[model samples]
Target: MSTSTAAAPVVADERVASKGPVAKLLGRPEIGALVGAIALFVFFAVVAPVFLQPSSIATVLYGASTIGIMAVGVSLLMIGGEFDLSTGVAVISSALTASLFSWYFSTNMWVGVVLALAVSLAIGFVNGWILIKTKLPSFIVTLATFLMLTGLNLGLTRLIGGSVSSPSTSTMDGFASAKAVFASSVNLAGVDVNITVFIWIALVAVASWILLRTRVGNWIFAVGGDANAARAVGVPVVRTKIGLFMGVGFCGWILGMHNLFAFATVQSGEGIGNEFLYIIAAVIGGCLLTGGYGSAVGGAIGAFIFGMANKGIVYAEWNPDWFKFFLGLMLLLATIVNLVVKKRAEAK
Candidate 1:
């Protein structure tokens, strides 16, 4: 009897030992993001002495804020097992919405803001409705939406301004508040830091809260982990997914409003090709392409890395063309490492 009890205890210990490595790997998904950020910073700082300058750092933070905001939203949706390809066009459309309202109607800035957000949420619902109802892959559904919105953005900008290349915001009224929220700078330790940075910070805080502290965050994790199981357990998987899609659109709109207010002008084609960048940032932040796990903070860090590399290279007097090459390398490396780690974790 004593021998039988001893054997059972040993078996339990073996099971735990087998899971130890896997547990370690899954401890914190953001570990890779931290390591990548540090590694890149060290590499760039060593190779380019100007990489750590105060102004250079500020520029990196500012340039990354808009995309960082979008990436955070994408990370959330990815965590819930969905994707939004229309984010790029959504960004332009949101900005254009605000721009047109302010430009033509002399509408209240607040009204333009409301309209931009509402339009994005409406589009998100449409995307969700199509994907959930048809049981179609979100990738294909959003891709179609992406093309459609792109065409509309371009056509409407031309219709409004009579020219695509020089989209004008001069006629936009109540530009002051928009600038204060999106473009205006506050003196931070003697540095002129754009309000967009604050927006990024606020977004991170809110996203982290929603993802970590709220029940909705748990649903996001569960829905991504296993949608069928989540639904069986009473989770509203479709609604949750639709909400995430809307989050992406909202992020895009915020960025659009920021641009419209900051420059008081925007290219009709602006934000085109930017959707991929947001995805890249989210992936680098440790959001799995296949979904289930991600970090809002990781997304922010990823954005910082991209922003730093883009501006840091320029400040260091390096060829701007090298930026694309560097970005490609970063994405490839992150993907490879993430895959290896994911496989190892699953192996147990």
Candidate 2:
């Protein structure tokens, strides 16, 4: 048996009869991120008078929704001990594919969306399969993918659409319905909330359930924590990792659709550095660099922190150049804090 499985009962014994509430709370992967988020929110709200306004709230939610969608997937994959540097470019690729396909074929918009989904999932599978087969580091594998997708995004758009951006899909058949579902906003007591906010929230809920309640969740944690050991204990390590990558692809599809519908066009060269933002959010939200422990809710909280900081910087009248500085500072701080928390959790 794997070390984790062998020690499961001892941990359960501690859980049921030894560790108190304080220890339990300390063991939570998201606790540090949660605390940090609250602190960041308060700091921003106190300084930026408009930070708490309804419109500002909506803006934060919209921004968070974009990154949060990807953060959840990244967090899960991180828990599985891998990274996908191609995610940002992949989003653009998916969007471009959908827009161009729908326009060229004169088909229903949904057809293009489904095709995009298939393409994204296939890319994910290739990434996962190649990594497992070649025994390569995920960083190297995805870095190559990132570069390839970047070239493809620009090259394919020019070759097929004669521009750096795909043609507007706003007028395509079924676009209105797709927009209403993915990009529309609803008013709540005069405050407009983006539909993506709802989607992000639902995704968090579902991901949390999967992580905390399902057998697959345990498998994910096991594989990330120690793949060799997990395999020894009968975990399908390869399948788990591939599924995690595909989950990321699924989120990329969702975000791609939203981006295309929201702006009515997909830029071939868009989404270059945004992968860093998603990773930073996941890291800030409590996913460890070594993986094996993290939370979906933590990632959501991290995205919220990013959304708030992004707009809060503007609202506070800070120089735009400092945004990257702030993000990097947060990432470092969160990583240090997560390490300390992990130590505490493992301590008796």
Candidate 3:
């Protein structure tokens, strides 16, 4: 009896093993982004002699870090079947808010930091709440926020800082510590690596863990796949969306602080149109425009590709105007590749 049972399980395991690793990898959401990134790297490396230089790599990573931070946030939210148009201006809004408060009260930089975080979180909450309450499309809801924040950023900066940009907070109290936390750099192999790189990496790690190892992650996929179906199955769609947006707000705070401390001043007019880059990076990372299929690491890889192409064009001495053309072409190509990959993955 025991021997018969052992062989039964063994045969089942052997049969499952026949699927092969290639098929398994192809099924993963990140596969397309990974392949595209590799291809792009090779293309640039061949055409741009200096693309392989140490400092050049650092520049690419730095650019990725800046966009990657937000990419992580939007990726998570996108995986939950939503978009946040306000994200771009929200970044500038937070920076302006922090700088204005810090300058106004002559308080510790942390004071402004804390207040700015609160404000950002509130903005996220409002965006989510309004969407849920109105039953409108997220695109419409967040577009309104984008417009509102764009105005408030400019208006508030002028009202408080008396200029289109916030006053410098470089010499404010607690500036040094804040700088260390948000804007400091470390020497890595004789190359200066911004602290944002570490932060972005950590975020990707945590997000991947959340999406893969936690119950919340399951809910995210389910909700994005179908909110009504997820809710019927007892998933809290509202909280999940609200939390996702709040997560975006949290990243906004981090990036905003970095902007403030890195430059010591905040430009209210900055960050407009940057949201498109974040969305594009996330899309390129394997997150579907329709939602419910993506990964945090994919988002990072997508940003890496963006960063590489950004600097690679300069290194290749190509016209900057052609960058968008490359992006559009890549987007179309990647989508087609991913569609085939997903179909293959689900075929079994």
Residue 284 of model 3 has an lDDT of 85
lDDT agreement with native, every candidate: 0.82, 0.89, 0.90
In the range 1-348, model 2's lDDT, one tens digit per residue, is 345545665444323445679889888888887787888889988999888898998999899999999998989999999988999999999999899999988998999999999999988898899999999999999999999999999999999889999998888899999899888999888999999999999999999999989999999999889999999999999999999999989889999999999999998999998888888888888887687989999899989988987888998999979988998888788778877988988876
Error of 2 at 119 (Å): 0.7
- Candidate 1 lDDT over residue span 233-332, tens digit each: 9999999998888888888878888887777777778777888889999898888777788889878988987897788788778899999999999888
TM-score to true structure, per model: 0.89, 0.94, 0.95
Clashing pairs for predicted structure model 2, backbone only: none
Report the lDDT tens digits of candidate 3 across residue range 9-124: 55554335456788888888988989999999999999997999888988888889889999999999999999999998999888888889989989999999999999999988
Off by over 4 Å in 1: 1-26, 165-167, 170-172, 342-348
Pairs in steric clash, model 3? none
lDDT of 1: 0.82
